[model samples]
Target chain A: MVPINEMKSKCRFAIILGVTLAIGNFFRVPYAFSEPIVFIANDSVPMDSITRKELKDIYTGKTKLWGNGDKIVLTFLKQTDVYAYFLRNYVNKTPTQFVNYWRNMVFMGKATFIPKSIKEEDKLMEYISSTKGAIGYISSNKLIKGIKVIAVK
Target chain B: MKKNRMIINVVFSILFIYSAEVDAYSSDTVINGFITQGYMKTDENNFLTDTEEGSFEFNEMGIKFSSAISNNLSIGIQFFARDIGDLGNDDITVDWAFADYLFYNWAGIRIGKIKIPHGFYNESRDNGIARTFIFLPQSVYSDPWRDSLLTIKGAGFYGYLYGLSYQLQIGIMDAQTDGGLAKKFNDITKSSIESIQPETAIIFSLQSTDLIDGLKIGGSVSKWDWKMDLTIQDMPAKSDDEALLWAISIEYAKNAFLFSAEYSIFDVETPIDLYVSPTAAPYRLPYATNNVMEGYYGSISYRMTDWFEIGVYHSIFYSNKKDRSGKDNVKYYNWKDYYSWSKDTCLTFRFDLNQNWIFKLEGHYNDGFYNGYITDNIDKDGNEDVEQYWYLFAAKLMYAF
Candidate 1:
């Protein structure tokens, strides 16, 4: 048999441990809380900022060409967490819904290109850096060299 | 065997050309396709097929490929096959093949076979998995007009101006008389149409998507000229006509709810010449008249969850808007089986079994005898045996990628 004070102390410790674990789990995935950062090819793209609506239009294939008559190449991170977060906030759609929209567009002969999806952050960055007219998004903390961070108005 | 050989040859030729083009621009090439199969049955009348005894002869399959040739030019092609009872007969044909060139963010041009820009859903009508219902509102999207309005061989100009998207097309079309529209004319005239030749066509559409976050309001107008040749008991006659079709549509989709409405009218002016057999009469008959068809539908859908959705719609169609009641048709034609309109109420449910598979079920309550496009509903004596009221059920399974 334990004393009453010791039992109370043990119970308090267990509660604190559970809370700590929950908080840690919630923040363990950077996508859950971090805002997505928009990026473009530093050398090819001349635009520095884009409106949220313009971004949405570009992602949805509504805006196919940029101002300089260059095609807008789109790239996407395939990680489910970050992709879901970006779709929900930027496009006002779920990941599945966004995919379905593209599929319908492609099948109906409305759009010719589907965004390139890359699983690794490094690979996405590399592709954007190497390709002209390329644009993509990453987590806030994953910003790398050779890519321009554009502000979403 | 001949059809199979032709299909194989076409497939191989497309593959060879596509591969060579891909090798030239290997960076951005994508391929996708879908398959759908459906079953339908009606209690009394055949709707689109032999549905009175239940039928599974409705299926659709398509394959599409697209590639970017340059920064501002891209090309795409799609091959489609379908069997809607006796309509498609499992014929594989070119759905659309176009080369798109973008001059500016606001303007572009597409050359080749292009999809017709009609109502909101007309362009994507073949994509079953993307829609909430297995069958769209039939009043506006009549089955008989599907083949005639699917695509046009010509050029189109598309652009965005002040937040409004517009598409204009000018093309040539060859009309086929085996479709539903021709059948309806035959039923009315008691004649068999041998051929139809389409002279020219033009279509224009304008849609605004920026008024609200998820709202779209649009209108479309299409006009065409056609010449038809008919045979009535060994007597031949020719007729020429001009048809004008126009529609207004509005749709709003936000969150888990979607609402849409559309109204359309088809006006036709034709000169008809009628003649009886030599044994019956040698005198000419006068049966020329102008015709107008009008239809409208309103629908609402709610997504209960990520995987489930339900929708309902009420649609109404009139063979002649001026004569909303059948009294004029019955009196003028001296026919007792004439019906001037159809009113249909439909309920649909959809389940997304997974990301790539979808299942849908639909039920319809119909009133009137306007649904005679399906040949099975007509009697062997060339008479129509149709009930004034009926029920129909349909189910479809689709796999898309």
Candidate 2:
């Protein structure tokens, strides 16, 4: 007979693996748009590249300030396919879960929440250009003149 | 003491204003608010309210004002009102008012009245639009103790580590003498408890945020001293003791599905020694027992469509960890076995009517009566038996911006 402790450990690992596999299979749908989106930041932002983890931190309201202590303003997107794709690929949350996260942050003294229901690419670019330390995701084709694109590592 | 608290709050408000004046700010003011109304009915138990008659006394409303003063500073305040059973009665009160200053990406300090981050959902439990269920699992999130567990009138600090986040708080619990906690204790000891006072508590929380995508593992521990004053018969009695609670939590989300689980332990010393019966045979206290409570729950939800979702959770609670059955109570006071534990299974359906409106309906199958539920029917019928099985139905509608 297998040892009880070893068997329990193996069982735990199997459950984890099964759940991961299920998530992978369930999220295998193709992106709604063929062209990938790019992250755009304010021109005054000092950093031109960000790690995946850092991007997640900014979007989730964990990293409230930049390296030089400038406040970071987040851009909220309309509930569209692009928003869903960004939440899944970058933030690693479902759309509803992400919205819940935002609501929690807002209720817990995150005073800077200004939800921009901007679906037009021009409006997003304008908001990013006007607001310092602002970051958002837009289609590569919509990367306008005022905003600077940050490469994701 | 009340005057001192008022002065302290006013001082904090002044400090927030001075900080804003000294710092160069982007100057953006935002106003946000929400309202929720609910209907509930229970088949057997009163459930802390008169829900047996399909009561519509469950409702809450809140309005908040917040502003970012500068790159490193922000201030916010909220006014909240609610009517649950006989509690609150739509009394407008300040929910949370605080000033937070960020020193670095890994360090920040917050002062003034702030929400206590308990379990996974305590901080946002009042935000109905953010939750999928009409009621969070009662095993972990007891509504009767909300007055004591909601917020603190002190300060704390928070930060992020390598792949985890941590928060440490040192604060005194808001001492509401006429809260539901006093009522529950009164019922427990067969006395009229007037006040429940809590010592300055220390709460520490740690959670893994980046270890796995869409997965979070967390733990929290809180310790505090407690004192209560009660009147049994025509005599006044009081006792001071200590209390401690801790919990471990795990949550995961992928695609349109979410799964969460939590386990908690609450250890509290009882003050029943003061409640001696004057007319009993030995003229002694009935139940002189310390309570080591245990609770746990597991839940899952699936978003079937953009506007429709369904969820389920099963919760278990025991009033005493050592005596899972009420054999001690039966030997001491003859209370039934089911008085020591409760098991609840719930199914909920949620509909997002629009961006600002949501509606939810839920049903519960409850076994046992230890979940702060009281029944007067048994007394009216002059029976010794209590309902061992019962059901509850709840519906809620909310609008938020």
Candidate 3:
């Protein structure tokens, strides 16, 4: 009989391999963590390239309290791998850690929230079209009139 | 405490306005909104006392607006109104009003009266287009028939990366099922399900479609606690009430096949000791008041050479919560017999009228008792047990923009 522990370890390895292969077969990573869609507040904040690191820092609360003294407004597409990529590429934290971190920070009275954290590309477009200080992103294919797209670092 | 909360909310609102101005400078104005209406009639289903039928009625209307103040900063606000139909008066309420700042898509914060994102549905529960039916799977999503008063007032961060979303919130808020008004719309203060309490809750969800087109799966877990003052049976006490909820759901649709299901479990802790009796033998004071709720429904619609398509669905709900000691019960391991369970099953047939409208006829069967231990003794005539059964028929017309 195959050693139980070794067999179990082999089974686990096979499962991991299968899952990884299956995932690899199904989804492809986006060109960057930043969504294809972008937004602008005023002329002072140039409509230009954003470094992935700076983007991550801003989102993760490492860089709280904007120079303008306003709390950062964060928006997100509801649960999607794009969010995972953004978290991994920029925030350098797992989604669970990120959520826990923010919850802890908010409890300490150190942060505020963004009004709309939408998943649908259309809704993200709508946010980009109306709000002033609102910065959001969506799929490139979903792009339409009113919203702007900035470059990623 | 009340005055302090009011002041805090006021202060946050002011801060939001200031940020809004800054956001206006660089952010483009974005406007978004949706409208949904549902019509249905039910005869002797769930907890409704009477059977009634109704035509199409406007169920929800809402608008959300946001703007990016700068490349790294933004703000957003949302306003919505709902019509609960016969469950109560035709009332309108602001569903969610908040401001957010995203330093990046990876991280941001939200403040104001927030949707206490505790499950997969908390934030999107009001969006009608997100679900196929007029009503959601009750036991798994909205248990104890209470949700309107469950939202919170506070601030937290919301972030998404790769394929996950997260939310954490803290505040002094009202509890559901307590029969008090904790939320306000303009000047109208509606009665809430529970009295006010300080609360802390967290939500984390993960989803992926990159693995397969038109298929998504995710899970969420939440825990919250509330402070309560209750007087049951003329006994008064100050207590802490807590509940933990967990759920997992999956969705897949391609061509004509669509399937979705969600399962949720909740454990509630009350504040009372045990009292022994036959029908009311308190199972476990300071024990485990546990309830498991779940629902799954799958449907298929074939193009069938255009013009028309037909679909059928089945859904089930079950709740097992035995309340023995009223408000002062703890989940002690002793009293296990006090728990009871109830089940509701439904079947639906729907017909499509083009891309924007559909008509459905549905029926529900319910086993009225909370626990299987209770015999169906409704008839009392001794010939047969009167089990609860009902049907709902509805026609809906929707326009998507």
Name the top lDDT candidate. 1
Candidate 2's TM-score reads 0.86
**Model 2, C-alpha of A73: deviation from truth (Å):** 1.1
Could you tell me which 10 consecutive residues in candidate 3 chain B have the lowest summed lDDT?
Answer: B182-191
User: Which candidate should be chosen as best, given DockQ against the real structure?
Assistant: 2
Please identify model 3 stretches exceeding 4 Å from their true place.
A1-153, B1-37, B45-50, B53-58, B85-88, B116-119, B143-150, B168-194, B233-239, B272-313, B321-387, B397-401
Ranking by lDDT: 1, 2, 3
How much is B235 displaced in model 3, in angstroms? 4.6
lDDT of each prediction vs. the true structure? 0.76, 0.74, 0.45
Assess each model's interface with DockQ, reporting 2 decimals per model.
0.16, 0.23, 0.04
Q: What fraction of native interface contacts does model 1 preserve?
A: 0.37
B336: Cα error in model 2, Å: 2.0
Collision count of model 2: 0
A44-150 in candidate 3: lDDT tens per residue?
Answer: 23446676645655575555444454544556665466656555555544443355345333322223332335677676656655654345555555535645565
* Tens digits of per-residue lDDT for model 1, B184-266: 77767767899998887999999998587878899999998888888876787677888898999999987666789999998
**Residue-wise lDDT of candidate 3 within B1-401, one digit each (tens)?**
34533553464455445544544222365444444555665553312212243444435554455555655454555554444433322233455556666665447777877765544445555553323444455545443333433466777676655545555665544344322112210001111223435567554455443245446677766666776543333433344667666667776654433556666666655453233443564433333234333433333322222223333333334343344222322233221221222334444444444433444444444433231111112234643232334345554444321
Output the worst ten-in-a-row residue range by lDDT, candidate 1 chain B: B18-27
Stretches of candidate 1 off by over 4 Å are: A1-42, B1-29, B275-288, B332-338, B379-383
Fnat, model by model in order, equals: 0.37, 0.29, 0.00
